[model samples]
Target chain A: MTVLLDVRGLNVTIGGKPVCEQLDLTIEANQSWALLGRNGAGKTTLVHQLAGLRPVEAGRIRINGHDLTELSPKARAREIGVLLQHSSRGFGASVFETVLSGRHPHLSTMAWENAEDHAIAKRAIARLGLDALSERSLDTLSGGELRRVELARLLAQETSLCLLDEPMNHLDLAYQASSLDVLYQTYVAPSRAMLMVLHDPNLAYRACDHWLILLGDGHWRAGPRDSVADPALLSLTYGHPIERIDSTHGPVFMPRTSLEGAPDNHDAAD
Target chain B: MPTAQHKRILVLALFAGLVSLWLATSTGGTAIPATEVLTHLLSNDGSTHDEIVDRLRLPRALSAFAVGGLLALAGAFMQVLLRNPLGDPYILGISGGASAAVLGVMLLGLPAFWHTPGALVGALFSTLLVFGLSRGAGDWRSERLLLTGVVIAAGWSALISFVLSISPPVRLPGMLFWLMGDLGDADRPLLPLLLMSLGLAIGLLRARDLNLAARGLTQAASLGVNTARLRLELYFLGALLTAAAVATAGAVGFIGLIVPHMVRRLGGTDHRILLPAAALLGGALLVLADTAARSVISPMQLPVGVLTALLGVPTFLFLLHRRVRT
Candidate 1:
């Protein structure tokens, strides 16, 4: 199998604090993995380094035999599609223009859009059910709708690897399923790989073939979903006793206590 | 659908521009008929009507149109580059820098070259200074940039006031007239420079990288935009255009801040369309505004800049309200 993304000794820091330390990850083509962590577990920071938004402080990252540090920004953008956690509300771009901006990596300077770019944007928008809102300002969208728009933009990038930070954030129940479904059907089912930061363990188990869980204090474990989904491993990650509950689909987590100083009985109510 | 409205507006502005040009030439201090002015403009004969229409009215009208267009285009570029509605040509102290340089020259009895070259140098210098100070340890901060520009503007305005207060009576009228900003001094030497700046602005309008750069430094860099280089290029282009306009017509204001807002409101905020549309509409709008300045008081003309403020502020406030309501 072709290795799509390879990271060794990766360390990420922001504002003088180490977010992720001594991390190593490898992803192969056609692989789909969920990056599971609690809040502030450095999932976003790790992926940001992979996307080249923030420089990696102490490690080497290679994508398809090309050293990421040596590649120009345009070249890196041509191969990796990133979906940030929350896009700015001030962009004021229309839905179509926002998606079209993803094609910037492929076009030359002073070049006008050709027919192919427009067709790609149209297909991405259609996949997200945003054809009706093609001309509407992005600022007018609800949170879930905005997430789908961002996904469409990633689709427009047409890269081989996706580095998504919390792809399911701000989505409602139905749209949460929809967002994952679309990501699975579009990117994962084919040959491309996806490394997505996920907050919900149930969503992680349901959608991802592989799981990588980051403990609060920088320790992490990664393997196939069945190998990493045990209650003991999850309890070590979230730092509380976790119980499996019966669900129509399968098993799901029920936390015995809140890690953030909430009362123990409140978990049942939640 | 909205494109149809834009086309209608463009046609209306063009028709208004033609009518105002005729009215400006005819209703000057010595009232000539429109037919005679047109005939004089077309003829090579050194007739009395020909001298008035060609030497006096036409240059002033052209200066007003060009300076107005330049300032508006600069403003539109600044607004997009900084991602702030308040970012105009003057927001970064370009006008204050020019004004201070000119005031220093007029007050200190400098050589003849001081007026034009001083203005351009000052405008370019201040743009670089603002760009330098607003940069963070790694990237540019919008709030800091705006604050630094405001500070520079305040300091320069105070210096200009000091110069004006201490100047001798002999140069006071010239200095004060320059400050008031009339289109009365449109000499032949300035026409080529105005055209050059217009060309530069048109070239900048083709920079597609600017669209990506407007979305914050991090966002821009993630999309393969060379954020640092594009920022410097845009600042250079905007400053060059503004300084050239300031050099020609002496501190025209308010057109830059208002015209781009109107364009963004009508044509959408995409720079591919906003840049060109703002330039044309701004030129036509100012031509008509200058006509009103000259014709409303007849023998005693109000300063063209004053008329622009009087017309622009109210419309801007109305647009603000309308935009808020929608």
Candidate 2:
């Protein structure tokens, strides 16, 4: 399989704070990877770097063997579709128009709504079960529906690689399943791959073909799903007492919910 | 939902345009009979009525329409590009910059308004200041650009006030008159340049890149838009549009800011439709406003800017209320 993206010695710093340092990762075609991390673990930062939205403090990121640093943003977008951490504001646009914006990377500066663009956008909206709401305002949709619409927008981009930040956040169980299912069934097939930021271990275990768990202290591990085992590893990965058990739904991590409402104890995780 | 509503609003806008046209030409300082007005325009005889109809009122009326359309188009373009509802040439200090240059020429003992290259200098200086503060080659942001424009505009306004305070009394009335704004004293020779600038602005807007641009810079770039290059082009085009409008009518206020918003309310947010609709509606609105200003105090001309401000503030508030209520 061809490698779609390669990140080597990646380091990113924002506002004088180190977010990512000496991080190395690679994504191959036909692969599905779940990026698991706690809040403030640089997951969004990593995805942004891959999408070429952020400048690399130091390192190389290549998409489809083309060096990202060398490629223009427009060119990079043609290969990778990125869904932001949250839905955008100020648009007040309809679902169709929003989805149609995804085709902007493929069309020329003078081209209007050609048949091909509409066909692709329609397919994407159908995949998300948003046909009924295609003409509806995006603002009026539920959180889950909005996420699905945004996902449909990414699918309309028709890129080889998908970079999603917290794709499952704020989604109900049904929507979480449906959203990921649409992505996997339609886009992330044998030829393309996806890298998604996730919070729930069970969701990650169920949906991902590979796993990347970033520890709270900046270190991370990556490999096949089987490598994500070992309670000790998961505990250290989260910097807290995490209990991983085999449930009917597969692997579920039960963090010490006891820590909820507890006084600040930053060093205890060490 | 928005699409259907947008279609309906577009229809309403067309109707409004027709109504505005009739109202604007009818209610003016010298209310000539409709039949006589038409006869004067169509006739070749150099009659006094013909001169008043063709040479005086017609040019002024047309210029008002053109300037209004140009400013609104510019404002709409800026708002979309910057992704801010508040984005306009005046809000961002581009107008202040233009005013400052005009002020300099007016009070600094330069030759009369006839010698002032005020619009271009002012707009360019302000736009350059905005460009410098917002981003370098690779770091542009809408918020940053807006903030920088605000700061620059405030500073320039202060400088203008100081200069005005110290200038000789002889120059004071001209300065005040220029600042208050009027379409009645337009230089007919400048009309061609105004038309060219408006045409150029419309051309730049027709590019597919502008549609992507409305979606924010990162997304636009990702979609293959040359962000920096487009920004430079848009900034220049926006400045040109403002300069043309200022040159034509001497700082007519609020037409640029309000017309775009009003059009968006009726025509949806697609720049393709939005710009044209704004152009028509803006031109119509300003003409009507000017007519109202003249008629309300007949035989004595009102500063068109004062009427625009009075009408604009209330209309804008009503639009805001409608947006919220809807």
Candidate 3:
């Protein structure tokens, strides 16, 4: 299996605090990794670094055998697509126009969108079930609708690697499921890789084949789901006791609740 | 897609612009008949009507049109660069800087044409200052840039007041008239017209990326916009357009702030269409305003900028109210 993304000796700091130090990660084709972290644990920061939006303090990152630093922003965008957490609205562009802008990297600077570009954008919008809202201005869309519109843009980018930051944000349960399903269908092919920041453990567990847990204070663990999804590791990573419930389909994690005055699981374990 | 409707609006704006240009040229303090003005233009006759039409009114009308077009184009680019509806050339302090410099030149009793170079220098200085201040510690957010510009604009306004207060009484009226954006002394219109054309071309070429930029920096960059480069280009282009307009006609207001918004409301948001439409409509609107300014009181002319504000404020408010109601 050829590795599509390689990160070696990575160090990232935000606001003078070290978030990731000496981290190494390698993603092979057809692998979807879920990045799980607490608030302020730098999950979004790491994703930004991967997307080349933020500079790494010390590290080497290569996507598709090309050093990330060597590629211009346009070139980098051709191979790696990112769905940001939030984008400002009120640009007064139609949803179709906004989505079509994703084809910018593929076209020359002065070239308008050709037939293929329009077709791809249309298809992506349809995939996200936003065909009805194609002509609507971005300012009029609800939060969930806007998220889906952004998802369509991400899809239209047609990059081999996708870095999604909280991709399920502002989505209802049905939309969350449908969007994840679309992402899975589109990105789970050979020669493709996806890394997403997800808050829901069960959703991540079910949708992703690998787990990357970021413990606070620049500590992290990464491995295949079977090896890294242990209850103890999950519990320690979140700083809360997590109980795993096994269903016929898969395991679900719930926060461990204790009666008042009772010793917590961490204390009992210690 | 909807090219027919957009094309119709463009045609209508062009026709209206031609009519306004004719009206501005023919109906001034002298009030030559339209047919006589057209015959003089067509026949190249050396009559007094021909002299007035060719030498005085033509240049002034074209200057007004060029200045208005440059300002509106600059405003459109600024709005996209800052991602704010209120973004305009004046908001970036370019106009204030130019006004202060021109006032300084007047205070020194320099030749009339000296104010152009003075305004240009002041504009460049302010652009660099804002650009440098916004780049502190490698933080280049648009909101920070806008705040820096607004604060600097306020500072320039204070300096303009200082210059106005201490100026010799003899130069006060000229200074006041210039500050009110009068085009009476706008002798050279060629440079402004050329710069306006160049600005419009650049706007059209980068319209797609600008559309993406209107969303936000990260969104534009994520879609391969080379956002840093785009932002730099937009900043320089916007400053150049503002400088050209300010140099041509001192500190014209409201046209820059209002024309682009009006274009977007009437036409659409695609910068490709929005930009050309803005140029034509801005030119036409300014020509109409200048005509009203000169003819409304016959020989006693009002400053074109004052008329624009008087005309624009109510129209803008009406548009806002209607937009909200809808």
Candidate 4:
């Protein structure tokens, strides 16, 4: 396999405290890597750095061997598609208009989106099952519907590496399954890959083939699923006692109750 | 990519703008037939009302249209820059600075020629002041920029009041009339019209990137937009346009504040369709308002600034009602 994204010495700091330090990560095509971390583990920051939305400090990130900082914004956008965590509500543009904006990088100054661009945008919208809502304004959309619109935009963007921050946010159970299926079908090819920030370890384990777990205080572990998904290590990383439950399926993680303020495993999923 | 409906709106807006210019020039204190106004505009031949039509009425009407277009374009830029729907040219205190400078020139007994340059200088100075103070370390966050602009505008307001208080009683009515935004003395139409065209060109060139920017800065950056540079461009472009319009017409209010919103309500919010549509519709609206201001009381004209709201509110409500019905 070919590497799509390469990072070296990536340092993630929030409010002067380091969360991840000297982090080296390599994502290859045909692999879905789940980035697991606690609330303040700088997951969003790391994602922003990789997407080149924010300037990377004390690190080097290269997409397809081109230095992230050196690439023009349009060139870089063709390589990395970013799905932000929270889209501002009250987008005044219509669904088709917002999705069409994904073609911004592909267009030159003073040149408009051609018929091919509109057709591609329409196809992406239809893929996300939003064909009927294309003419409607985005402010009228529900959270789940809006997330679908963003996904459609990402599809229209057609970048090689997709950095998804909370792709499952605001999605229902059915939409979640359908959304991952759409992403996997489209991106898990020989020339494209994805790194998603997910909170649920069970879903991450079942959906992804690789793991990049951020332990607190500038430490992380990145490897294939079999070597990195350890019960004791996860327990240590989460600061709670995690029990590995082997059910009818292969395996899933569960946290043990300490009897004080901690809830049982069943309640933990909520 | 403008859709068919957007094209229709654009065409209608252009027609309305032309018709409005004819209406404005025809209905002033010395009334002439609309056909005669059109004939004079086209033939360029001398007639009894030749001075009134060509020299006085035509230039003033064109000035009103260009100033209105400038304010509307500036308003659209401000909305995108600050990410607020209520963004307008006057909100940045550009007009306040112009007012203070013009008042200073009057009170200081300077040559009358200094008023235009003084207003332009003051407006640009206020723009730079807001630009420098807003980006404290190095970022143009909307909340910070908006707050900084609002505070500076308040400062200009205080200065304007102080100048007003100390002014001689002889110049007070003239200054007050100027502050109310009259088009009576604004007979030079060429510069503002040229600036409007330039503004439209630059605005349309950046329209696609502007659409992405409207979503948010981070999203805009992620989608290959140079958000930082775009913010600077929008801030300065809005300031420049506002400065020119204020210099021409002494802070005409409603055209800038409400025209872009009216356009968005009629057309979609895509800047490709929004920018040109705003310029045309805003030009037409201001032309009609200025005509009404001059013609309603005949020899004695109402303040064009006050007349803008008087005409604009009813038109906006009608548009709103029609939008709901559709």
For each candidate in the order shown, give its overall lDDT on alpha carbons. Answer: 0.75, 0.74, 0.84, 0.84
Model 2 chain A, poorest ten-residue lDDT window?
A: A85-94
**How well does chain A score by TM in each candidate?**
0.89, 0.90, 0.94, 0.93
Chain B TM-score for candidate 4: 0.87
- Off-target runs (Cα >4 Å) in candidate 3 are A257-270, B127-154, B314-326
Pairs that clash in candidate 1: none
Model 2's chain B TM-score? 0.82
Q: Is model 4 an incorrect, acceptable, medium or high docking prediction?
A: medium
**What would the TM-scores of all predictions be?**
0.86, 0.85, 0.92, 0.92
Q: What would the per-residue lDDT of candidate 4 be over residues B188-255, giving only the tens digit for each residue?
A: 88888998889889999899888887778899899999987998888677877876787777778757
Better of 1 and 4 by DockQ: 4
lDDT of 2 by residue, B188-212 (tens): 6356345645654554455456656
TM-score of 3: 0.92
Question: For candidate 3, lDDT tens digit of each residue in B233-279?
Answer: 88778878887888777888768778888877774687877888889
TM-score of chain A of 4: 0.93
2 against 3, candidate with superior lDDT: 3
Clashing pairs in 3: none
lDDT of 1 by residue, A126-199 (tens): 98889999988866888788788888988988888898888887788887777778788876745579989987
TM-score, model 1, chain B versus true chain B = 0.84
lDDT of 2 by residue, A127-195 (tens): 888999998876578878888888888999989899888887668878777888888875567658999
Per-model fnat list: 0.54, 0.43, 0.63, 0.78
